[model samples]
Target: MLIDIFHDTVCPWCRIGKKHLFDALAQRQEQEVHIRWHPFLLDNTVPAEGYEFRSFMQNRKGIKAEEIQQIFDNAQRAGEAAGVKLDFDKIRLAVNTKLSHQLIALAPANVKNDVVEAIYQAYFEDGLNIGNFDVIVAIGTAYQMDASELKSQLNDRAVSDAVIAESTFARLNGINSVPFFVINDKVKVNGSHSVEVFLETLNRAALLDIPAKI
Candidate 1:
């Protein structure tokens, strides 16, 4: 089955959703699944340098102090439930993830999952700035991708364009949220649903005729 996940690195729900999907796949050990990560920019207009995390939440997202605290608290609980650690306090920046998306696009299929997980861990778990080129290069090197080659590819115009194109396609398809799952292009599951929901969707998709691609 082909599982295309539309997500952004900085999205807390995306992180949680990925963990749930992985858990679901693990339970279905006999199934063969091809997972693909699609890019979705939460804020395409963010500057290359990005914005201060708290300030952006307050100014741009209009989240007040108490509401932000509640959000973080809920996110922490969700992360714990998903077996993913989220260090919200350590995060200092909410960055533009265009370059990170490009890097994922350039990664080989076998290593793409690892790359995506690493990006989520780096940003949400460790509170690192994934928008920085150095951070992204380090991640690629850790995954055994050539540092120089990965860096080159990340800066390539074609690679960047491909990431943008994918995002545009998602927007055109009326998917304006992250952590949206399209199973075999026949079933669409939105948000951070439970593992059971994903497995059920997979089962349902298997019974239907493959839909024509959009």
Candidate 2:
């Protein structure tokens, strides 16, 4: 089975959705599943250097500091339930995800998922600036991607354009949110659904893939 996962590296809910999807897949170990990670930029206008995390979110949401804290508390609780850690306080910037997406696109299939997971960990857990070239390079290298080659590709104009194009494609396809999924090119699951929901969707898609009896 092939699952196309549209998500942003900096999205806490995307991480939770990922956990749910994997948890569902774990229940069906007999089937072979391939994941294709696609980019979805939550805020494309964030400058290359990025914005001050707290202020940016507050301004964008038009919420007071206390209200923002409440939002964080909600996200933290959701993350905990999904078995994903979200250290929102550690986040210093809300960065443009173009470079990070390009890095993921350049990765080999075998370790691509690993690269994705590491990027999420670096951003959401470690609060590292994933939009930074050096930080992305570090994540790439950890997954055995050639450092010099990775840097070169990241600097390539075409690579960056391709990442943007993919995000645009998602938007054109009516995917206006992160953590959206397409299963087996037939089942469409939106949002960060629960493990049970994912499992049911997976089973339904799998059944749909079966050949009809004569």
Candidate 3:
């Protein structure tokens, strides 16, 4: 099975969804599954340097403090239920995830999952600015990717453009939200579905004779 996950590193629900997907896969360990991470920027206009998390949500989304608090509360509950911890209070900045996505794209298949998980941990747990080059380099190196090569590729225009192009392709394909999952390119599961729901989708997709492409 080929699971094409379209998500941004900064999305809390994306982190939860990833956990659910992994859990579902774990249950079906006998089946072969390949995951391909794709880019989907939640706010493409966010500056590379990023903005204070509170100010960015309030100013850009025009969300009131009460509503934002409610959102955080709900996310916390959801994350807990999914065996993931989302420390919104620790997040200082809301950053552009273009560079983070580029790193994921550059990661080798064996370490790609680790790269993605590390990015999620850095942004949502550690509250690190994933948009920062040094922060991303640190995460890449920790995942065993060549730090110097990762840094060089991150600075290259072609790599950045490719990440942008992937985001554009996602938007063109009608993916308007994060945590979107495409199974074998034939079934689409949107949102942060539960583990059972994800498992059901995977089972259904497995029944099909579609060629898996990752």
Best by lDDT: 3
lDDT of 1: 0.88
Q: Model 2 shows how many backbone clashes?
A: 0
Of candidates 2 and 1, the better by lDDT: 2
- Tens digits of per-residue lDDT, candidate 1, 1-214, equal 7889999999999999999989988978887788888999988788877888987887876879888878888998999998998888989998999988987887888999999999989998888888899999998888899988988888889988888898999999999888899888769999998889877877788788575353
**TM-score of each prediction:** 0.95, 0.96, 0.97
- Best by the TM-score measure: 3
* Clash totals, every prediction: 0, 0, 0
Output the better candidate (2/3) by lDDT.
3
Model 1: which residue pairs collide?
none
Alpha-carbon lDDT, every model: 0.88, 0.90, 0.91
- Tens-digit lDDT track for model 2 on 103-193? 9899999999888889989988898888999999999999888999988999999999988899999999899998999888778998998
Flag clash pairs in model 2.
Answer: none
- Candidate 3, TM-score vs. the true structure? 0.97
